[model samples]
Target chain A: MAFASSRSRPDPAAAPDGPAYLPSSVRNMVKLVVAGGLGVGKTTLIRSVSETRSLHTEEVMTAPSSRVDSLAFTPRKTHTTVTMDFGRLTLGESGETVLYLFGTPGQARFRQAWLDTAYGARGALVLMDLRRPEVSYEAMDLVEESGMPYAVAVNDFPGSPVLDAATVRADLDLHPETPLLFCNALERESSIDALIGLVSHSLDVYRRNTGP
Target chain B: MSRRRDPVRITPAYLATGGRTSARRALPDVLTRLVRVDGRAAASLSPPQHHLLTAVDGGDLTLADAAGHLRLPVSAVRILAGDLLDLGLIQAVEPAELPDVELLENVLDGLRKLKKPA
Candidate 1:
């Protein structure tokens, strides 16, 4: 429920300067998804890494989508909305490649909307909550269904007990090839490391799929 | 005798932007960057549309970036951008395909430089 922009600031890379708006020698804007359950800090991670203040774009669900998308859970009398938090981080010294991080809502009802956000994304970073390991299933399932390789980051929430990593991994049913790491989403360094892990893992996945 | 309604007003409350609420929809793709093609054509656009052109005219920003820069909703901005596109006021630059190895290496290198010590 927290707005991710609280900690966000204007990234030096995204200043009013020429490099901020224009594409340089190599113009690459890659979409990346920060996937996780309700309180696992998807938005926090994006806010930590974004150069500019993160923008959470709310797309209000109209009557048609509610009628079709809101099954299982009864639709509210009012509009049902989906929020996709967007953040931009410039990668490489030249800043040729910009990562557009989309932090998606993790819920059973928003599956379709989540996929809509994930579309065209090169990969996803799945945030896992050790306290409620079951919620990780929803995130992993969505990413798997989309067929984009993903990495898992266990958010170090204040009260979460430090348990055996293997047991947590077993509960989540993670793939052997998947990369797993620990992170405190609120911390810039921790979040960046998690992201680095994801981008690195995704690169390997892509190489495997496409061959040498 | 029947009375005539105000032509500029569409709904009773939403008459702010001269009734051009923008039926405008459609954008090429999220990654498509746009640049102004005709400066003169921009003159005919509404204030919002002109605002969009000015931002896009600054550089080759994607539809999403343009919307972000203009602080307008993506859907609404897409619609207005689409209208300008149909008139050839702007050109959409489709992104080139990037190899995975090169892309990943670039990102990893960038992250290494940016991330502070644990």
Candidate 2:
């Protein structure tokens, strides 16, 4: 169980003879995953922040999946996520690179993939469509079960009821510390700002729990 | 430093699987002894090392699992894993692929039942 420490990386002060490792000024990359129910605008939000030329991830859709997959809630939707969606974005002047704007498949059948994607993520943005509020509990449960901190992003859908944050939190029975924000996923700046806020808040909470 | 020269035992399963073939083949006829430093020194590991050790001790976690558990970048996890390997505290094991769909579905169903509203 013994692991090499991150601090063991050649430190300029500790190892003068050590080769220059990471650039002094370069910011370390931080990964944040964007997750939600299907068609909850995960793609739209990533497209907003991603620089041109996002990476393409293609997975195969197998036929036998029909037997193992849960189609209860999902209508007969074609085009199984033969590919996963991911994007990269830079945050703040620190130039911290954040990879994995991962678009999770919404269907419960894809729960395995979703769990795999959740691996290694610092935190997640769980998107909820106000129109289909009940649909989000499943995603919320996954996030909670993984023991990763997550922020709820209520996407403003047309004709959707405007539920207050308190009401939403009550319905979801989330911990008070979990941040919840309203977002128009179609808007680039707003979505980014929401994510930024989530990251900051999550870091603060994590630090408090684990200490600096 | 307390040095002990324990015979390095390679398991037949490892040899049969042809895992780490190069390292196995190139291993010296006599394995170098491991020197144990003071427990106090070992207790105070760097952040990355601490995270790696925590992940490894938790179970047969993968590099990605360690990174995720520590909330560290993958590159950082990889770098730390290399160090642990050198120290002979951990060894890389091929990850088991996803279970069959039926198995996964059954597991999920079990999880769902467990989560049912009490």
Candidate 3:
């Protein structure tokens, strides 16, 4: 089903409440982390592949409230709210499985929050902008610390530098086994390819860990 | 109703969880997918517990989604869910192990099928 210049029109499938609930057949719910710096297209990639409209949820930091309490003895308290965008993708013929993509920041400031988001995740899809490759270092390190498999997807932006995969790998100081690929985050197929790379790599890791 | 009129209306955390700060088992995170298992429990639930169950009634929604839907802090939601779990009113779908090899393969196959043609 192709449309002429479909980008110009809103997608009915992307309606915020299109399907109020997951199909009853769903049994397994898997999660993957979409981590990157601000403006690295985490949400864009999620929107591209997500079956439903992306949803945003907030994680409130409770520590700051006490600090603000001592400052002025005021009733008002301050809390740092970090918003995470996520979307759902139902799989299997009966839609018995569902995958969730959670868009999260890879910064150190949200280390505590990562405990909640990264928990029980299968892997991480760390998006990088080759023009500013330095921004992805924290994300890579964070994923490594979590001990889960992660793949780096270089999201190509206009006028971004085009370096060979090996050079980019060395620049990012990535492990040899870590999968690195490129994709245009705005394109659904391209983004799915990136996710495919990550999940395949995760399968390889799982095999290596569990033995034949 | 206005922030100016009532600057800070703090609902003590204990009020939400009956002074139970921690659950018997590890708490489910925001991403944990939860579903209502015992519909009959609705009749005996407190208001907060009822809202949590209602939030997950028809579908398997993530804890974060329930928090957002209920307009409650994620921490409160965790505690509320913990109580629900103790009562066997709800269940989380997360597996004890990392998504197994078969599941990963299924995800890969699904992604391949959903890919748009170039």
Of 1 and 2, the candidate ranking higher by TM-score: 1
Candidate DockQ values, in order, are: 0.30, 0.03, 0.38
Give candidate 1 regions above 4 Å deviation.
Answer: A1-26, A65-67, A71-78, B1-29, B38-40, B43-48, B69-73, B95-97, B116-118
Residue-level lDDT of model 3, residues A1-212, one tens digit each, is 22332353356366444223666677767889999888999999998877666766565655433233223432354456567888778776777778889888877666656657788788999999988877877777888899999999999999999899999899888889999999999887688889999999998998888788
TM-score of each: 0.79, 0.51, 0.81
Candidate 3 wrong stretches, greater than 4 Å: A1-20, A64-78, B1-25, B29-31, B39-47, B71-73, B95-99, B116-118
lDDT of 1 at A199: 86
User: lDDT: which is higher, 2 or 3?
Assistant: 3
- Candidate 2 regions with alpha-carbon error over 4 angstroms: A1-27, A61-82, A92-96, B1-118
Each model's C-alpha lDDT? 0.69, 0.51, 0.74
Candidate 2 local accuracy as lDDT? 0.51
What is candidate 2's lDDT per residue for A1-212, written digit by digit as tens? Answer: 00122123223245322211222232323445677777888888876655432333333233333323634434575324433555544333343222336666544566655665566565788888878877767777777777776899888888878788889889878788888899888766567666765666656656566554
| lDDT, residue B20, model 3 | 57
Q: Let me know the DockQ for model 1.
A: 0.30
- Listed for every candidate in order, the interface RMSD values in angstroms are 4.1, 18.3, 3.4
TM-score, second chain, candidate 2: 0.43
